[model samples]
Target: MSPRFEPITGRYLNLTLLGRPHRLYIEEAGQGIPLLCLHTAGSDGRQYRGLLNDKRITDNYRVIVFDMPWHGKSSPPEGYQNEEYKLTSRGYIQMILEIAGALELDKPVVMGCSIGGRIVLYLAHQHAKRFRAIIGLESAAHVAPYYDVEWLHRPDVHGGEVSAGVVSGLIAPTAPDNHRWETLWHYLQSGPGIFKGDLHFYKVDGDIRGKIDEIDGRASNLYLLTGEYDYSCTSEGTLDIAKRTGAEAQIMKGLGHFPMSEDPQKFISYLLPVLEKIRGAA
Candidate 1:
């Protein structure tokens, strides 16, 4: 028997973000139009392993996923143990632009999930010219805070276990046990305060409902795909965004917040048509 290899390749890069030096990790594969993927809160680029490996997608698009600072294989800035980690909307947007610039990706189509999902709206509104298209998975303008952020980082509590347990219910019951656990593992593996930091941006500062109408994109240029079972970013909320922005939208069935990772095959079924549409318009 021969050892099988996946086409995925990863590398490290040193970049200056927010005027500070940091080391970031990135993975990529396939070739063609650039497709930059953003992971959900508390997770990393590994969530898109399915999309990265799927020849159906990779065959037509070059896929890229970079773990943000303080997440996955990426390391934080030079400061050691000074302040609490927090993700501000400006910083988040700046980081994405920095990464895209550093990679020298020319007007790539950007797709993001959860926090990644929410930010695309801002991207389309503020920098639509910079991207060929934007896709938001489990996207909504605002998600009502479901839990207290403080609990995830308190001294008495175990951050990883509690964080994983809290989000476990967000996954659809239909997800395979293997993938469900894998999704939880990302939460479990998250660094102390990192998940909380992501959520600070996700819950407190990442609301776009007031300016949803301001986001500029045609039906062919913007997309919102939310899992039916995702309570955090309900399909209802996503549909409302679509209604206002007049962007393409769909509610994926039998999937949850972490669609690409939770069930790759099922997620692809919903995604291929979107890819075809993007390709046609491109």
Candidate 2:
């Protein structure tokens, strides 16, 4: 049967976090258990547009995606551009906590990709009891050198175009042309230096290799799924984390760094089983 499209609502909320007030853009659909989805670095919540429109998942989950401050429709707090906006582990967790509290989400299943994926490790370690489960897509225990941050922000280079070109190389060669382009489109629109700032967190502050043992999978279901073609956060790296933390891990075939957007159908194929497991556990 063809899947029906569900109605999605977009709204904005002004909340104070990290000692500052910022506007956050949120898109939500369906009605059931909450699923808070976080987007890849430099990109916005638009990555989950397909899931928000899918009735099958939406029928069983209230899916919500939000743009981080300074990304997408969310406006940055005062003095954001003047001072470099680097993402910190503490600040990232605080943002999620604030958003969830404001939305009154009851132990939502938190999912994220790329840097979004990296942040979930912190969430699981720091606030496991607050979430029903945490799914880290293309997450790794340690993210070594893959893409150069300097090249991404060089004044001589066209930041957006160059960023898209670099990201395109990381996507799976098997991904559809349309899907690949659609995924690249987000990078092309991202603000300058935003990607680099996010990488600071992904490659540096987000490292949890030594602390993976601190996470209790029994209390907060931790799952790691990496794309077959993701060179940055390889499946081997993710599997290592899973082994260390006792969290479930899987490799998505024919997928890449941006699985949810690169090929939603293929992504869902892998995600469905994970969701079912979470539901059963709940």
Computed on alpha carbons, the lDDT of every model, listed in order, comes to 0.90, 0.88
Model 2 stretches astray by more than 4 angstroms: 1-6
Give the residue spans of candidate 1 off by over 4 A: none
Error of 2 at 238 (Å): 0.9
Candidate 2: clashing pairs of residues: none
User: Positional deviation of 101 in candidate 2, in angstroms?
Assistant: 0.9
Candidate 2 CA-lDDT value:
0.88
135-161 in candidate 1: lDDT tens per residue? 999998887787788899988999999
Q: Pick the candidate with the highest TM-score.
A: 1
TM-score of each: 0.97, 0.95
Model 2 misses residue 59 by how many Å? 0.3
